[model samples]
Target chain A: MSSEAMVVGVVGGGQLARMLHQAAISLGVRVVVLDPDAGCSAALAGAERFDGTWTSAEDLVAFSRSGVDVVTFDHELTDPADLRVLERESPVPVRPGPATKLLAQDKLHARTTFAARGLPVPAFAEVATAEDVAAFAGEHGWPVVLKARRGGYDGRGVWILADRDAAATVLADAEGIPGFLVEELVDLAAEVSVMVARRPSGERRAWPTFVTTQVDGICTEVILGGDAGPAGLAERARELALDLAEQAGLTGVMAVELFVTRDGELRINELACRPHNSGHVTMDSCVTDQFEQHLRAVLDLPLGAPDPLVDAAVMVNVLGGPDPWDREGLTDALAVEDATLHLYGKGHRPGRKLGHVNAVGATVEQARTRARAVADALGSP
Target chain B: MSSEAMVVGVVGGGQLARMLHQAAISLGVRVVVLDPDAGCSAALAGAERFDGTWTSAEDLVAFSRSGVDVVTFDHELTDPADLRVLERESPVPVRPGPATKLLAQDKLHARTTFAARGLPVPAFAEVATAEDVAAFAGEHGWPVVLKARRGGYDGRGVWILADRDAAATVLADAEGIPGFLVEELVDLAAEVSVMVARRPSGERRAWPTFVTTQVDGICTEVILGGDAGPAGLAERARELALDLAEQAGLTGVMAVELFVTRDGELRINELACRPHNSGHVTMDSCVTDQFEQHLRAVLDLPLGAPDPLVDAAVMVNVLGGPDPWDREGLTDALAVEDATLHLYGKGHRPGRKLGHVNAVGATVEQARTRARAVADALGSP
Candidate 1:
């Protein structure tokens, strides 16, 4: 509350941190980002750079020594053990703490916690053996989703088992892993995500639930302000997300991914403890960009208003295709009226989240169509 | 062009350079900035920092020695001799080249050039002595505008002469300055500026001219995409600017300041070779931001369209007020539904350009009103 500038320290120097750096700079706040590479845009955007792994205790200690007001992350892979150490030794605040972050970091734990909280989750069970998977399928019916309990992102660690034979093969391969979660494969009409920001002071706010489209389990596009569900469902989803944040002891931006079935039933799918790809559209379409709000929440400042600035906004991820990443045709892409492109300074890897493009339009479908066209022009699959 | 990355060097570290850096990054290009400070935002934006004076030949040589693909500036204050040396030795493209930059760098040269080109400009003469000022005013006018030929900006280095007596006082006090221009002071109705981008390939584009309001010679606000003159006059201004660019062998974004007299005649007032303050609203209001277009033009990329995205947009500068700058009530400014605030990370100084706020509305006046309210809330004078 004082007139002095606030310094926020972010862990991991990925696109999320790069955006947070941009947001902090806009508000005249300084950010210190500790990343594994110095070439990341986060470092380029005036964040005091310290190169090291986030999992290293010594590096975290050095990062905490910067006298930052708060510490957050661009990725959830931050070592929980190191965070626990930081909470005790560092003077700066750590949002979401280790407990809430663990819920989202580990798939098995997230399911258990949501189930215990009496939330609307798909029918699920944690399995360690083929028999356990078969038994769960026998009870919940066929065609279930098998997921790794940790470190899966962008459609990397999930598989659908339509029958007992496939379930046997998947479970046999999951022997050494912590465990796998089996969930009913609900027939979904669409997927949506509600991004919310919460502070330790108990203030919470959520952006409008946007209908998300995914291909092969990787989020491909987001349609803002859509009528994907029944009337008033967005508000309900926000309430659920806020409640979940509180229950999970979250203290920053957290995205709750949800499924809307053919019957209009809403189900909580998963959660991300930091800025989500689904919220990337906010950089161009929201009154208060989500990254800025995240910094505000984590720094214990008053939460900003979460209002969509446009009637419809669609964000399409620029995932790398089989072809080499040439960044060619960007001139044509930039020629799109009202198009905003954010390229993460990440290396080219097939199906990797290289960047995203957001387009604002009068309708979600129109925005989505434009966004997809731009993404395709940028070599998206 | 080869797909390999290339570097562009900028000679200043102001907000224009900062925005240009952002634009360059989107095109997969890099920039090296030579600012006088180490911790400036442009330096942090991956601009390899070389801190020194812009007018120093040694500094310019050091900056030019880096083999940067091109050398440009956010502001046109480079010493002419140093620029000429760099052009001969390094062969890096220098936009607005040295010849056009003088039209802005030296008021006397600009006036004479405007007259020679048969463009509409105020009646003016180079005043080496107070007698010359008196003669010029006696011949064409009573009140006159006296401006120092170089090294003045943002209301500085300009004086209004009411009569021979006032002119005598300024000339007596401004002894040995050697370079001053006396101009016929037109009874102005409104002020406007046209922002145009030109490529080395002879391609040129211009954004709509907008009426600007000034306080104490510093621009207070801009009303974008509004008619500042008749449609025919506006088109003429754009053509004249493009013609001027071609004549001067200039390549990059250029802003032309003009006066629309009560008689509906438009006259050239001044020229800015870099991104001007009047173009700030283009960051959020235009299809291709002026800063981005400047990069595209200088890099020889095909320029994007310069269409206005909104019906009207207003940009209000956050001028430092009389009261010591306070961070109080900034949240209130940030809370405005349609206002976008951009704060430069600089220590406050009286009458300094810290940042600006932009707003869009159905009408120019409405947007201007909202922008001013936000700037006022941030303690602008």
Candidate 2:
């Protein structure tokens, strides 16, 4: 009912920020994107572009003075120290603050904090050398997982080692990568993610737990009403995500990615302090999508219902392919009735995310089949 | 499916253009708005602003050369003669062309065309003086409706003259007004509208018929599955709308406003070349909202399905109130679950359209009740 429009400054201008910009129009809000790339995807969507990077405190200060009511990040690459400096120097409110964002930016910090809070997470230890990894593997067993504590994504920062000799080789190969951590590699059954939005006023809501399929360390597909994994796993995932949101004082959308072991134990894998790819299905199937919810959370507005609009829905990401970018099969893909396609307006690169397609149907299998077909069509030459 | 992003040039920067800009993001298209007002609602949504008016041929030429693939109008105020000149000078294709747009811009032309085509329209005649109005009234009876040929919106260009004396006074006061047409006032019933999207390639689709409630000639609310007027009136309205779209060679969304007579006969009332207020409910209830459909039609892409996602939906317009714009009751309005609010980022003036609220429910009455409550809250002091 208010005619007052709020300007939200986002630190990154990727697809998440692009979607947030789109969602803000209906809410009468303005999004100012601060990305070094002049042609970032969000900027293409008409976001007020400010040429800046995550590490530039001077740029953040200038953006704060440019009338942004609140500042949030599209990615967790911003250094907590830089954010703190911005918070102290600028008048704009930094949502989810540095402390909360750090839990997502640093894997070791999240694992340690969740472990200390009596939450279920993989057994992990800081790995300074091959011996540290060997020691951890000796206690946990062979085939342990090694991960870089920061700046690792899409399986790039992680390695699975079979023995102490393999650990030494991996450690040697990862010479320049900083902040290594070793963890037990559990016998996994499946992977699932839960998205939660929390406002500064403490109001929080969680979307339904959904299953995610990963290929080469990147999410390829997500299905709602996921394969009824361990009897109570879904409920537990929702509870854990909500509990973490409350404990972390999260002031926007956060996703908790979890691994379901063969023995039915649920363990937290990682956290994303922004809208995650696993929730893209919500765009077409839920009463309120995650991007809109993220804006509401940061703006401290009342959360909307997260109920599903259809019986089942699935989303498939269209990764860049070996062939050059072309819409050769787009007409055929669009012929798959009821399937919604969203192109990110980005240049093509092998294995890079180009866009996503969502399909809702009477059953999950039907939705997944239609969604995959459309995504395959989009990726084909 | 082409990777080439299409740039759409819109001639107005009002709420319709704002919504179109929002819709373009998902389609991976770009919208360039040409409006003289830098602070127009669409410009605030991040549309590329052209900083010019529709009447300026130089601006139109520059916009076309700036890489806009197609040009469209959000309002009917653009003179057809000006558009003709621009079309001859610019390479960009102007959708609906000048001829189709003229039908909506000039009432006399539309009435004459539809009548010549043997369409069901009220008996009407051109009136240039008080004697002409008196002569038309002598034949069609008293209490006839008079409408300006151009530049009228809401209730501004229309008047109901009761007798010869009133007609004389009205014509005397109408000194410099443009062309006028006097028509027989139809007997009471209900008013409804049907929206259709037509592509240049001959593809056409229509949404379900709905009823509109008007206050002082401005739409206040629209309800889907309108009052069960005649047994088959809805079907007939759809047929007529589609027929008109094809007959006019329409290349975008066109709304056919119709009057349902007490005898179950449908009569043409007016036409809107762009997204109409009566179709706002489609944003929440239909598979494809009108704005997206408009873009699809103009681009010659496959039109999305118009099936309803819910059993019924209602949309209520939020008119500016006596009090200054404030968010005093926004929280309360948002508390109504499942109701979505869309605010146009425009400065408020009394009687101006500020926003709209939409609600979906099991029945039209139930949805209308909730939508009206939210709209009332938004307009309250």
Candidate 3:
């Protein structure tokens, strides 16, 4: 690796990659983004662009040859097998190597691995047919959550089935019964997430646990320094996240989403091994943001302090609304003294994550109110 | 101008422009940098590069044609006449217009204007020959400071002459004796600066005053919020900066450097109508950094709060050492947990500004110590 100028090759040019590219500039690092679209968000942010898809080995190899020191991913959609091949063929190192990346790509694999390690996770069973789902539901309860093992995001690959008939209908519509998993649906009071950064040397650090609110399976807002749940929930969530990072041998930022059940137990819901939406508040509220931390970890640099710079911070997503774009009210949003707006350079589409607003205040409620106001201003009228 | 995505055209691509581009990403503003060097620091950070010198009117016009909404500058090295021509020719508006820009480009003009407005300034006189210097020294006392009226930075274009013979020697060495100004050297106890952002609408905001320490006329460290002088010093500095911004019709970030006398009086020393090194600490220590404020002011967006995020912050510049580059000790520097490093992507040269390290702590002493340690580790062996 050239220490003069470290070049990181990211496999996707989404908002995560775009933010990483922005953070890289301060560290004197260069980011080369590999995406099929030439005008992806990262490209607009000035990352060196390589026209290629994540699944194409030839494109990945070309990107690696273009003077990149390390290869990483913005998302976990790339096949682990393809990454392994690239790792063996490319000159640069692939961070969060195939083994670690696969842990996040496949839901069944992650659940089974965590269970084997005696982690607190939802009761889960692999599903091949409607009978498998029915049997799992019979043991767990009347309602169960079904999730595809891979390639699903937002609300795309998850479903809550209350009975065998519902499972049968889902199964009948599937093509050749795609790989899936069934889990016992726990009674949730709130959802929280902990973000942790782990280097290849086994060094790990985590941010304070923060509460997240999702609407229609989409992250609508994140609240930090708020009443997350029962006492000790934050500590327990942090411990769980750190342990997972170590177990997975993660070499970058990892977000551990947890379900805070009504019974006060913490259950692992999902894992994302990249800069996450839940941690977006860190951009304005933390001493060192998650994107910069991810870059430092993947580069094996010493970790920065993750201390909060404010008493409370809240982030609200600016999901694309009915209008193509609503920038007229941007001035109004900017009127919120502490509201910091970030817009992903993307064409507008209903429900798309166009941007987000962050606000810091003495209390989480105040911060959230200000952030939501800015988000509302930026949204379609 | 498309509010959907504002494109700001910057006239220089140095470290200031590089930082502005980094800040622009979070604000969803695209920066088109017009610099002669294709590999300037801002270009390396992913800003759109328009190859052209600051003096080339054609280049400026071409840059404005590339879908820019407003034009700004990273430095005051541009010829004011060219800016005036570009203002008349280009479709986009030129911020800080040519009139405001001229106030910063010519030191004599700035001093004259400020002095005419009853600002507190050292006694000064323009010099055309050694006789002029001797005459000014007769009134101001020995060891008067002589400064070139334009294109001077760091220690360049500045000299101190103790007598007529010393002044005669300097004038003899000068190439055609550039336009110079003589000022009485003040018995200064410390140097402090206040950074303020102004819009064309006459709205102005200033950050907390900071103390700057310089060696050989180049700033080496900036300390914020601790022993910056008397309690009212900050308020006075802010008032002075705001008044200057208003009187000069300044737009964007303006830094007013003041000399704090041993007897507790503040005197204006210099003015920079862009992000200054004195405000670099704001990147890691303030709620909203100066670079972001510059972009906001130039874009006419509502200014953000400039509250300090910590009790104190210290920023130490990483002046280039004997070595062309220093990477071996980066890991050592990274050992300082709260020390954030910012390296401009530039080829190293002796005494050049390569980067800066910032640290925040409970006290300015603690932050300065940490920041200085990191900077030392990154310096020459």
Best by DockQ: 3
lDDT (tens digit, per residue) of candidate 2 on A34-125? 99998899998888888888788888878777788899888988877788898898887788788899889889999999999999999999
List of chain A TM-scores, every candidate: 0.94, 0.97, 0.97
Please report, as a residue range, the 10-residue window in candidate 1 chain B with the lowest summed lDDT.
Answer: B322-331
Best by lDDT: 3
- TM-score of each candidate structure, all chains considered together: 0.91, 0.95, 0.97
Q: In model 3, which residue pairs have backbone atoms overlapping below 3 Å? A: none
Q: Encode model 2's per-residue lDDT on B1-381: one tens digit a residue.
A: 335688899988999999999989988889989999988989989888888888888887787777888998788888778888877888978887888888888899999999999999999999988789989998989899988888888988899989888887777788667789999999958899999999998989999998888788898888886674978889999999999999998999999999888898999998999988888888877767899889988887778777776777899998777865455567667657777888899877887898898888778888888888777777632
For A1-381, candidate 1 gives per-residue lDDT tens digits of 212567888888877887787677556677778887777766654457777778798888778877787888888887678878878887777786888899888988888878887889899888877778889988988888989988888887899988888978876676556668889998998788999998887878889888888888888888887887787777788888988988887898999999988888789888999999999987777757688889878876667767776788899998776664443566556556667677765566677777898888888878887787777777778
Query: What's the TM-score of chain B for every model shown?
Result: 0.95, 0.97, 0.96
lDDT per residue (tens digit) for residues B98-135 in model 1:
88788888888888887897978988888867789989
lDDT value, residue A381 of candidate 3 = 23
Off by over 4 Å in 3: A1-3, B1-4
Off by over 4 Å in 2: A1-4, A230-232, B1-4, B138-140, B225-228
Task: Summarize candidate 3's per-residue lDDT along A217-321 as a digit string, tens digits.
Answer: 888889889888888989999998999898888999999999999999999999998889998999988878999999989888888889888899999998777
Which runs of model 1 end up more than 4 angstroms from their true locations?
A: A1-5, A44-46, A200-203, A225-239, A242-250, A302-306, A309-311, A322-332, A335-337, A361-374, B1-4, B44-46, B175-178, B225-249, B322-327, B361-370
DockQ values of all predictions: 0.31, 0.52, 0.57
lDDT, candidate 3, B181-226, per-residue tens: 8899999989999999998767888889998998889888898886
Q: Give the fraction of true interface contacts kept by model 1.
A: 0.20
Candidate 3 chain A: 10-residue stretch with minimal lDDT: A320-329
